[model samples]
Target: MSIRISAVAAEYGRGLRRSLDQVIGQIDEAKRTGVDLLVLPEACLGGYLADLSDADSTLVHDDPGPPELSVAGPELAELAAAAGELVVCLGFCEIADGRRFNSAVCFSGEGVHGVYRKVHQPLAEDSYYSAGSGFAAFDTPVGRLGMLICYDKAFPEAARALALDGAQVIVCMSAWPTSRTGAAANLADDRWTKRFNLFDAARALENQVVLASANQAGRFGTLRFVANAKVVGPGGDVLASTGVDAGAATVDVDVPSELAQARRFMCHLADRRPDTYYPPHSMLSVS
Candidate 1:
């Protein structure tokens, strides 16, 4: 009952055609490798912000931000066609009702399974993109899947909500960069990269669910991305990883069986005392 899953670390840019060509090739390769699900880096459809030097600059990059596309756009349809039997999750900038948000969509040949707007924005990201409000899981061919974009994974409640709603596999897409002020000499030693990896492992361990973490790699604008895509087992163990380089990592996992085993002795989710917990949404932004 094990399903093969792959998480990718690669560079994508402003050229829509190039991105599609690369992704389609990846999808075709995954099909050959028997991958049931494929996770792509954030903004793979277009690209991520090039610079964040001035926090309140109100600029996505030196150029225009990645094309604002709708979920119903033809590009996604093209991707869906290529997906065929493989369920794929990837990110992009979404334009809805004249406002733009960071979004991810999961789909297969059957059609779109789910869409998740990133609920958490880091630094001055909110100045460029509007925030999403919630998290939910949806049925997919591989299993019940939940998706998060970039900073969303940094919040425990974001993944926990999906886990509670029956997500067996969680896919997180990011264009995460190295430290803004003080970066490590090596990409591997970068503090931001460590936090990114830690969040992927901790979220899976706490939720008792398998996790596929995909991230952008190489340099984009003024940012140097930390490419460390990986597949983590329910016990927080990284089964496969691309390290700090641009590559894809794959692993076979019997999600349900592993989830059962992880929760067999200590059921973290079931043992929760909601009555004793503080309200999650009580805090408001100071600015």
Candidate 2:
């Protein structure tokens, strides 16, 4: 049950053709290295927001924002074909039911396995894209997989839901940027960078599920990204990481064995007492 996972951190901007080329290149490398599952940053298919300064403003910003793409579009088809046997998870601005969603889609050469629209919207992100409804895990060649977008990982309930749904691994795609104010001179010293890394470990440790985190690198518009992609073990251990640079955190881990070892005695999910939870969403159910 050993799986090879690659958490990718790279630059993706407004050019659709360039973005596709960048992702395809990574896929080519992963294929050569025998990666079973590859997770790319949020909005890697198009790009992320130009700036967070006016997200809270009701006034429509002049910037057009990330180009919206359908889950059934040709871009995804092209990625699927390039994926061949590899399971690839990537983010995009999804247009569905007349609303745009910050979404992630999982697919392979065979076809799509599942899709996740980010349920939690941060800051003024809600002003642009409508939030997703819930969290769910789907079966894949790698294992039972759950997906979360950028800010969704900030909420413990999101990851917990997928764990309860039998997810062995969680793919968290993000376009997280450096601090807007009191900006740190170094990327690694940035407080937001620490939180980005902390959330990845915390979610994995608490849920006893392997976590694969990917993020955008470089800068786009008024945002400068913190490219700290990583793969974390169920025990809160950093198995591999790309630091604050643009690259992939690649690792070979035995999923079931790690989960079993970590949960040998203090199984977080099994030990939960849902009955004691508060009335409103303390113990929510996807059913």
Candidate 3:
């Protein structure tokens, strides 16, 4: 069975009400387009922080944190209601047990299905939120699904772990920005944007699974986001893309059949040699 999916590359500011309105509008559009799954950028609900710089240790230590909301809060409940039967995956700042986490939540009219806290943090983001312990896949309306937030997709092991656990579709939500040090004259020529696209294709190709990636757009604080939302086929083909702009990339694909075809010749997951794998330093010493 084929399922329609959409990845949104849009800007979300610090206004909670405005952000929620945008999400509802997106859901309305997704429903009209018959989108079974809608993926939104990281921190789409409450918005990410202005700067992630740790240049001044004092400022890093003294800075106020992201706005926190409960996964079971009214915000998510409203989102679930707005989604109706359409499955939606969106990033938010989650507050659980008085602690804040950079989290992504999946839900429908039936309510929340799964939640994933970001495990890998670039720069000094760890100073703001705690890291997630592990990765896991869960059943969703579209397919067996896995989720990765921003920097989590940078690690091959994270996607591999989820694929091994039976994830057929992986959605990566990112608030990725343009170059930090050397600014690019054109946003399209930004190196970070290139890396974002490369990682999405590489991870999908290596895992033999469908990949849907959504990212933030426009500028927020010191960061100019790279809006390159796209859906990649199991064979690492770009099924649909929004390019480097604020829009939605939508595609319809038979995920199971695609996975089967990609793995037919050589199943990357099945062809494993874990026993021979050793630490890099240990391997060098042995050689």
Ranking by lDDT: 2, 1, 3
On residues 1-287, what C-alpha lDDT tens digit does candidate 2 reach at each position?
79899999998988788989989999999999999999999999768877766763323445667888998899999999999999999999999989999999999998999999999887778878898999999999889999999898999999999999999999999999999898798999999999999999999999999999999999987789999999999999999999999999999999999999999999999999887776645546688
| Alpha-carbon local distance difference test for all models | 0.91, 0.92, 0.90
| Model 1 segments more than 4 A misplaced | 55-61, 279-287
Error of 3 at 128 (Å): 1.3
In model 2, which range of ten residues has the least summed lDDT? Answer: 55-64
TM-score per prediction, in order, is 0.94, 0.94, 0.94
Write the residue-wise lDDT of candidate 1 on 1-287 in tens digits.
99999999999987878988999998999999999999998888878876766664435444776788899999899999999999999998899999988899999999899998889988877877889999999999899999999888889999999999999999999999999978998999999999999999999999999999999999878889999999999999999999999988998999999999999999999999987677654656798
Clashing pairs in 1: none
Question: What TM-score does structure 1 among the candidates reach?
Answer: 0.94
